[model samples]
Target chain A: MSFSHVAIIGLGLLGGSIGLAVRAELPGTKTTGYDADPDVRARARERGLADTVLDDPAEAVRGADLVILCVPVGAMGEAARAIEPGLSADTVISDVGSSKRSITDALVAALPNHQIIPAHPVAGTENSGPDAGFATLFHQRWCIVTPPAGADAEKVASLVDFWESLGALVETMDAEHHDLVLAVTSHIPHLIAYTIVGTASDLEDVTRSEVIKYSAGGFRDFTRIAASDPTMWRDVFLNNKDAVLEMLDRFLTDLALMREAIRAGDGEMMHDTFSRTRAIRRSIVALGQDDPRPDFGRADHE
Target chain B: MSFSHVAIIGLGLLGGSIGLAVRAELPGTKTTGYDADPDVRARARERGLADTVLDDPAEAVRGADLVILCVPVGAMGEAARAIEPGLSADTVISDVGSSKRSITDALVAALPNHQIIPAHPVAGTENSGPDAGFATLFHQRWCIVTPPAGADAEKVASLVDFWESLGALVETMDAEHHDLVLAVTSHIPHLIAYTIVGTASDLEDVTRSEVIKYSAGGFRDFTRIAASDPTMWRDVFLNNKDAVLEMLDRFLTDLALMREAIRAGDGEMMHDTFSRTRAIRRSIVALGQDDPRPDFGRADHE
Candidate 1:
């Protein structure tokens, strides 16, 4: 069964984008959105983020067939609990959290009677909040729908159908595997970007202005991801601690070897490593996962 | 004094770009280009990358008032030596290498009598070679000109004026400071991107296909830089070894602290660090060093 009414519990980039996408792609579906902050609710209404903007989370989800919590990963449990009173017994609950395992556990615990199917749409710009949402955010993006063990097959299919209707390619995976994959793909990259940007800014020898001025060399690429939402990333690291730490340790080990290679002036080893990484980039472009244009076509847009 | 005929050795991205930029922005200036690789020279000729594409490096620089060596950093000395037979006594020699001090020393040692000045245009796409260049590649980008101590001021002014004529903002500094600043801005950033991309690919648990598929989460940003010309990056790390090592150490220290915060569940630390990095991205945008649009406007183009 398709969701006739979808309730988005957070009116941020992901939530607002879902509301906008549903409206644009599925004209029959109605969207209701609510944010804990009243200012966001007002802005969402002004932007027409949903069919209706409600103040109370329960009121927003009252008659919704699908309730997707779009809060920070650490706040998923609280958001689920807030919408519990209004959720129907058959409402297929889901979330757009980066860490699947923790979000799945928290959501199941908070709404025991609801069918919780957590999913993460592997797409976003560096910007966030209500103003950052766009209808095409999920177009041509991957949305991993992670269902709990023994989840209702019909509901899972319905959730997948809903995401597909909004132009996302859905993949079903267990939460444990999803967390591990995302740790390597998402969390560690973010951590490294954050670390390097901080390192560049904190240098005594290189002034911040110089770093900003000459960033086009390569540093600006890191700054784009580094500017992502602080609260959301903080929760991602905290919620997916084990997987993040594991991936980070692996990355650190590899980085240490690279350091040694550079220190030893092993040009051959560095050249081999650098050359091997290019194939993956080509594959990413061939698979249509990233922009094929050089500099991500930034110069063209300018 | 302005150069009536400018010669570019090494018909790759930077050299081809300089040739095109001079042709587009300085109509009166004549351009001659040469590359050691016959294939690149053929391609550069087909693209009309310069007014003339010569097979011999010495022939290419014969009547030019200015000759810029645009080879990889490791080959600057040899490229300088190759063009020595054609150099006029008053020819102002310059280079576009990422590492300034080394290139300056290499150029000076190879051509002791020539007025050698090194400049790095902090601009490029990940893709390289002759076809990867464009006429507007240097538009609004910073071109750092590092003249050695006791260098002729008129020759330096000519070089700076030439870059400015091609729509670049020119800044003059000593070679040592230029190396240090770029080690933080360019070399280290590339080293980190190359390292992380390599790390993600080698993980047995996370298949290379999986990393490529889910790279949109953040890993894709690094891949753009990681996919940069491997030989060029290898030389960058080798030539700027001291500054790269020092900066890498600082980044490692900061990353370790972040690792502890993640392990300890210190959300506050992560939040503050993430928030602080946003300002740098904003400043970069304000200064026009990067594309201000989100996702570098990739989604819109799609």
Candidate 2:
């Protein structure tokens, strides 16, 4: 029950990467792609992002057995609707949205008769658009599948196998829990990064050039996350509002406590929390989520 | 005016790197190193971190024309006091503390009769200790030197020349201004990173494994910064209390506004801030403060 013909409805970073990865790792499968922007479509064609790059979503999905919506979360419903005229009755529908709950609801509302499975391949660089993706984008990364209740087991299994074939490790979880996990892991971190970078840029006392010059000490890391596509992140915050707000509350509580500790000059409390946080980083590196070499091994780039 | 024999008290990342960088870049100068922990001293000796790795701080400083304290900010005074017995009267004293004001005061108070200049080379990785140092650690990085008002120009110029010889681009700034700039650039970013990583780890609903598994979305970057040496960061926040608190207040204010924007579903505000922040990352890359490659160019390791 493997997917032989796949239609990617957005030829951006994730979509284009999927096309490239399928070609690189799952060479037997065929990929068709379409983008709303003609410029992106032309660029995707130039880069051979898909086997057949089409001008319309309906045209792209005509003979495909699977369709993956790779647009922003806020556009999931419209994108799902666009392919409805050409989607086969048995075609498995899925999307790569950062927030699963809203996208799941949107997809179901748009295509109630289709088999919709929402998945988030937790991988990317700060760059975006067609040129930002590479064949190895999903390598060694996690792809969380949030299949709705009563989804066909065979279809879901095939989808899992499809992602695994592209070098991603797959895990299945409920949409609500997926939303909560990602809100903690992705949404709130991005929001906090954007906020801090904004704060640094707006300071009257410290010039922006100084911040840029001295960024290697720490601030540069935050800027990378903050430089993500503004539209995608804006939709993420809007779509996953509940879980994001909940996580933000927890972050604020912890930040206030730290502020108090610093204000009181409580070195012990600061050290305790800072020391406790080291274990998670070690676990992340040990589990292969990140590079173990110093400075993410960038020192050797030259 | 140049330092012929240099003594580095505290053979951790910065001290060890200074020794290695001096050996690589300034072959004529001799470096003597000491660490408080005997285990670190042993490792430094095996690594040949200095020309002579002494077991005692007092022994390390004998007949040295320049002695640099590279201990944590809180330990600067005691490290200075330890070398008092062996310090030559003409030797120039300096330190590599992140926060300049408090370290400058501590060094001056501990060695009132010596020429004291405080410096901060804005460079490091999350990993610390003697094993983390490399000869190119300070290559193309900024070294901020803060000299007191009455300090000799010859001594200050020589200190600048020394840092330049070690591959750092040197800049002179007042101690208080140095604290303010670093509070915005380095200290506050580390505090926010520690706070966010702690917030994610302590969530009762989200298991730690889940957070670690899906960290690639953005949280992993924060964890790296948060994983930095706790004792050094604790002292940094404590020593630069006023500037850090001021910067934290600004960050909190901006964060609250972002929270309000998210709560209100104001996509435009979120987009505007997120988009504006990209310029800083570009400038940092343009200035060579960070690697411009995607994901810090870490993908090649596997």
> Best-fitting candidate, measured by DockQ?
1
Clash pairs, candidate 1, are none
Model 2 agreement with the true structure over B183-291: per-residue lDDT tens digits: 9889998998999899988988999999999999999999988999999999999999999999999998998999999999999999999999999999989888888
Candidate 2 per-residue lDDT, tens place, A1-302, comes to 99999999998889999999999998899999999999999999999999999988899999899999999999999999899999999999998999998999999999999999889999988989999878888888999999999999999999999999989999999999999999989998899889989999999889998999898889999999899999999999999999999999989998899999999999999999999999999999999999988888885323
Supply the DockQ value of model 2.
Answer: 0.78
Give the TM-score comparing model 1 with the true structure, all chains together: 0.99
Docking quality of model 2: it rates as medium
Candidate 1, overall lDDT?
0.91
Query: Fraction of true contacts reproduced, model 1?
Result: 0.84
DockQ value for model 1 = 0.80
Interface RMSD of each: 1.3, 1.4
Report every candidate's CA lDDT.
0.91, 0.92
